[model samples]
Target: VLGLGNVGPLAGKPVMEGKALLFKRFADIDAFDIEVQARDAGHLIDVVAAIAPGFGGINLEDIAAPVCFEVEETLQAMLDIPVFHDDQHGTAVIVAAALQNALELQGKELGRIKVAIVGAGAAGIAIARMLRALGVADIFLSDLHGVLHSGRRDLTQWHKPFAVAPQDWDLAAMLRGADVVIGVSVRGAIPEAALPMLAPKPVIFALANPDPEIDPAVARRLRPDAIIATGRSDMPNQVNNVLGFPFLFRGALDCRARQINQPMLLAAVDMLARLAREPVPDAVQAAYGLTATQGLAFGPEYIIPKPLDPRLRQRVSGAVTVAARESGVARR
Candidate 1:
C-alpha cells in the first residue's frame, strides 16, 4: 500500500494512481493510494498502523520532511512489514545510484569528493543522509535564505546532520571547488555562473521537476568536461524516484522483510549502478523507439536504467531480497 496525503490538491488521486499503475506494470504488485489527515506524527502513525496489517508493505509518499522522519520511523517500528517513505528514501536511492555511475564515468571517487545540495527539503536532506554510507563526507546544503550553517536559527533536525559550520557562504561560495551539485530545489537555484566554480570534471544533477536548477545544455556548454543530469525525461540521465520504489517494495515483500533497512537500500543502489554499465537490452531500446544506431549507451547521457527496463524487476528486487535476508530483516 502507498500512503499518500498532504501534498497538492487531492494528491492521493492522481499522483498515487500513477504510481499504482507503475507498481502493477513493473512488479505486479497491487498498490492503492489512501488520503490521510492528521495533525501530528502520532496521529499519522496511528492511522497507518491500523491499516498497515492488510498490506504487505507501506509506502509513504508526499509527506513533508521532519514529520516524514517521525512517521516512517514510528510506523516501521510498530509493524513487522516494511514501511518506506518514497519521498525521502526513494528519491535518495535513485540519486545515489545515478551519482554513483556518474562519478565512476568521470573517474571521481565518492570518498574524495564534496557534494553541494541545493534544497533542504525531504529529497535533498535524505540524499545527504544516505550518501554518508557511500563515503561522502563534505556535504553542504542551501535553502531559500542561503546556505545552511550552524548559525542558522531555522535548521531542522533533518538539516542538522548535513549542516556546515557557521559561515557566510552562499550557493556560489559552496560550489567553489565542490565536485558535484545535487539540486532538489526550484529552477535557477544553481546559477550558470556557479557551474564554473566547481572543480574539473564535476557532476551536476539539476533534478528539479519540469525545470531543473540549471539547464542541461547550458551546463554542458560551460563545462564540457562535466557530466549533467536532470529530472526531465527529454534530457538524458534523468535521476527519477520512479526508477526506485516499485522494485524496492517488490523485493521487501518477496522476502517478507521486516523493514526497509540501510543494507537493503544500499543493495538497490548498487544494483541500479551496475545495470547501467551493461549492454542495453533490445527490448528497452525498442520501448523507447530508438533506432539500431541510436542505442542507449552507458555514458554521461545514460547513467541509470530507463523506467521501462524489464531486467529491473528480477535484478534489483533479487539484490534487495538478498540484502534483506543477510541483514536479518527478511522473515522468510
Candidate 2:
C-alpha cells in the first residue's frame, strides 16, 4: 500500500489494515500495511519498487483515478511480484460475482442484459471491462457530465474504448429499460422515481460506500421485484471488495504470480458465482444470524457469499491460482 496523504491516507489506512487483518484471519497469509507519502506517481513507484523485494505482492489501496492506473501498470512492469490496484480489480470481481448470481435469480443471461453504470471512474471502467469479458455487450457508462460517448472532447484514453456513439439520453433516460444499474458514483445520484423506470426485476448494485445512489429501502418500495446490493455490511448482498482482494492477493502470493491478470479475475468471479449456488454452511448461517428456513439456500437475497464464510479462501484462492498458472503469469 502507498499514498498515505490527502483522502488516501485517512480513507485508505483503515481499509488496508482491515484487508491485512482479513488476509491473516482467513487464509493465514501474513500482510503488512505500509503507507508512503510520495509526492507524485513517479516517486510513489520508485518508493514501492525499492521496497518490493521484501514482500510477495504489492496491494495498491486508495490511490486516486488515472494515477492509480499508471502506478499499477508501472509497478507490474518493473517488479516481479504482483501489483494489484484493489479499487479497480477488487470491486470488479465482487460486482461480477454478484451480478452473475443476480442474473441467475432473475432468470436472465449476462449476454442479454442492458447495464447502465453510473460513474466512469476506475471501478466503473473495470466493471464494464469485466462484464464485457463475461459476455455482457450493451453497457452504458456515464459520469456527472453525462454518458461516455465517442464524440465527447474530454474523454481520456482509458475511457475511449468503452465509449459509445453520441446519444440524447442522460443517466435517468438510460435507466428507463436497463436490466442492471451499477452505481459507483456519489450519494443519492439515482432518484427514487428512476427505480420504477428500469426493466422489471432489475438488478441494482448501489455500490457507493457509506451511502448509495438509491437507498435499498426506497428501491424495494418502488420495485419490489428488483434485486438490490450495496457496499454495506448492514444490507443483504453487500458488494464489498473485502470479499475479493484478500483472497485474491493470497492466491497471487501463494503462486508467486508476476501479475494479477484478467483470466485470474474471471476465474475468481466464476468461483464466487458457483459458491453462492452451493448450500450455505451451518456456521455461515449462524454467523449472519440466518436460520435454515431464512438463509441456508441460495436465492435473490443471497446472491453472493458472506465475507465471513470460511469456504471463500479455499474456493476463490484455488480458482485464482489455477488461473495464474494457465494464464502463464505464475512463477511457482
Candidate 3:
C-alpha cells in the first residue's frame, strides 16, 4: 500500500491491516501487512519483486493510481505469483457483483443501464472497464475536476476508454436519468440533492471508504426505488472488498494459479451474486446477529453476500479454483 499512512498501525486504505484481519479469519490463509517507504514506482516495483518469492501472491493495497497501474502491471508481468491490486480488481469485483444483484432486484438489464462513476482513480477506472465487459454501453466518469469527456486533454489511457461526450460535465449533470451512480470518489462527492436526478430504481454504490458519497439512509429516504450500497458495514448492501479479495486469493492459491485473470474474477462475481440469492444460512444470520424479521434473505437490502458468510470460502473460492483450472492458468 503506497498510500500507507502513519495514523496508526492499521492505517492504509479501507480495511488496511496486515492484509486485513479477515484474511486468516475467513480464508485461513496467513496474511500480514507490510508498509514500504519507496521513492517512486520503480522502487515500489522493485520492493515487491524482491519479496515476491516469500508469498503465494501479492495484493497491492491502498496504492494510489496512475502509479498504481504502473506498479501493479509491472509486478504482475514480472512475477509468477498472482499480483493483485485489490483497489482496482477486488473493488471492481465486489461492485460488479452487488450491481448485478441490485439491478436484478430493480428489474433492470445491464446492457440497457446508464452508469455514472464518480472517481476516475484506479477503482473507478477498473469498475468502468468491468461494467463495459458486463454489457453496459453508457458510462460517464468524473474526477476531482469534472467528467472525463472528449474536451479533456488531461485524460490518460485508463480514462480515455470510458470517456463520453462532453454533454454532462459534473456529477449532477452526468447522473441525470442514469441508472446507476457508483461513487468511489471522496466522501460527500455525491450531493444529497443530486441523487434525485437518477433514473427510477437507480443502483447507487457509494463505495468510498470511511465515509461514502451519500449516506445510505439519506439515499433510501430520497429514492425509495433506489438500491443503495456503501463501503460501510453498518449499511445495507455494503460493498466490501473483503467479500472479494480473501476468497479470490484463497482460491487462486489453492489452485497454484499463475495470475488472477478476468475469468477468475468474473467467476467470483457470479459466485457472490448467486450466493446472495440462496437462503441465508443460520451461521450467517447469527454472525450478523440478525433476527428472522430483519430479513437476512436477498433483497434490495441484501444484494451481495455478507462478508462474514461462511459459505464464501467454499463457494467463491471453489468457483475461482475451477475458473483457474479451466482457464489453464493453474499449475495444480
Candidate 4:
C-alpha cells in the first residue's frame, strides 16, 4: 500500500494488515503489508516494481484515485505477475455479486435493469464496467457535477467511454424510476427525498463506508419495499471487498495467473452469487449470529456470502483459477 498518510494511514494500516492476515488464514497464502511513504504515483510505481520479483502478486490498496489508476495500470503492464487494485476491482466484484443475487430475489434480470451509479470514481467506473460485462445495458453514472454525458467538456478520458448523450437529469432525475441505485459516492449524497422517486422494489446499495450515501434505515422508512445494502458490517447485505480480494489473489497466485483479467473477476462474481443462493452453513450462520429461526437463507437481506464463511477460499478461488485458465491468462 502506498500513500499511507493523508488517506488515513492509521486506519488503512490495520486494514491492510488484516487483509494480509486473511490471505494467510483463509488460503495459506503468505502476504506482507508493505507501507511506502512515497507520495507521487510514479515514485510509488517504481517502488512497487522494484520489489515485484519477490512477490507473486501486488495488491494495491487505499491509494487515491486518478493516481491510483495510473499506478495500477503501469504496474500491471510492467509486471509479469498479477497486479490488482482491490479498491477498484474487489469492490466491483462484490457489488456485482450482491447485485446479482438482489436482482434474482426480486425476479429481475441483469439485462433488464436500469442502474444509476452515483460517484463516477474508480470503484464506480469499475462497477459499471463489471455490470456491463454481466449484461446490464442501461447504466447512468453521476459525479458531483452531473451525469457523465458526451456533451460534458469537463469529462476525463476515463469517463468518456461510459458517457451517454447529454441528459437534463442530475442525480435525482437519473434515479427516478431506475431499478437500481448504487452509491460509491460520499456520505449523504443520496438524500431521503430521492428514495421515493425510484422504481418500486429498487435495489439500493449505499456503499460508502463508515457512512452510506443514504442510511439504510432511512431508505427503508422512505421506501419500505427497497432492497438495501451498505458498506457496513452491522447492516444486512454489506457489500464488502473482503468477500473478494483474498480469495481472488489466492486463486490467481495458485494458478500462476498472468493478470487478474475481466473474465476472472466475472467468474468470482458468479461464484459469489451462486454461493449466496445455496444453503448457508451452520458455522457461517453462527459467525454472523444468525440462527435458523432468523431465516438466514438466500433472500434480500442475505444477498452475498458473509466475510467469515470458511468455504469462500475454496469456492471463489476455484472459480477464479478456472477463469484464468479459460481466459488464457494462466501461466501454470
Which model scores highest in lDDT? 4
lDDT, model 4: 0.88
Tens-digit lDDT track of model 1 for 93-121? 99999999999989999999999999888
lDDT string, candidate 4, 242-292, tens digits: 899989998998889989999999899999999999998888878877786
- Give the runs in model 1 whose Cα sits over 4 Å from its true position: 1-12
Best TM-score goes to which candidate? 1
State each candidate's clash count.
Answer: 0, 0, 1, 0
What is the per-residue lDDT of model 3 for residues 1-332, given as tens digits with 9 covering 90 to 100? Answer: 32233343235534456466778888988887777777788998999899889999998877777889999888889999899998899999999998999999999999998999998999999999899888899988999989899878998877888877766477678888999999988778998888888898888898777778887788889998898888888878888888998999999999999999999999999999999999998877887887766759889889999887889999999999999999999999
Q: Candidates' TM-scores? A: 0.95, 0.95, 0.94, 0.95
Query: What Cα-based lDDT does every candidate model obtain?
Result: 0.88, 0.87, 0.87, 0.88
RMSD in Å for candidate 1, one decimal? 2.3
- Model 2 residue pairs with clashes: none
Which 10-residue span in candidate 3 carries the lowest summed lDDT? 1-10
**Global CA lDDT computed for model 1:** 0.88
Candidate 3 backbone overlaps, count = 1
Candidate 2 error regions (>4 Å): 1-5, 8-12
Error of 1 at 19 (Å): 1.2
Local error of candidate 3 at 97, Å?
0.7
What's model 1's lDDT at 174? 92
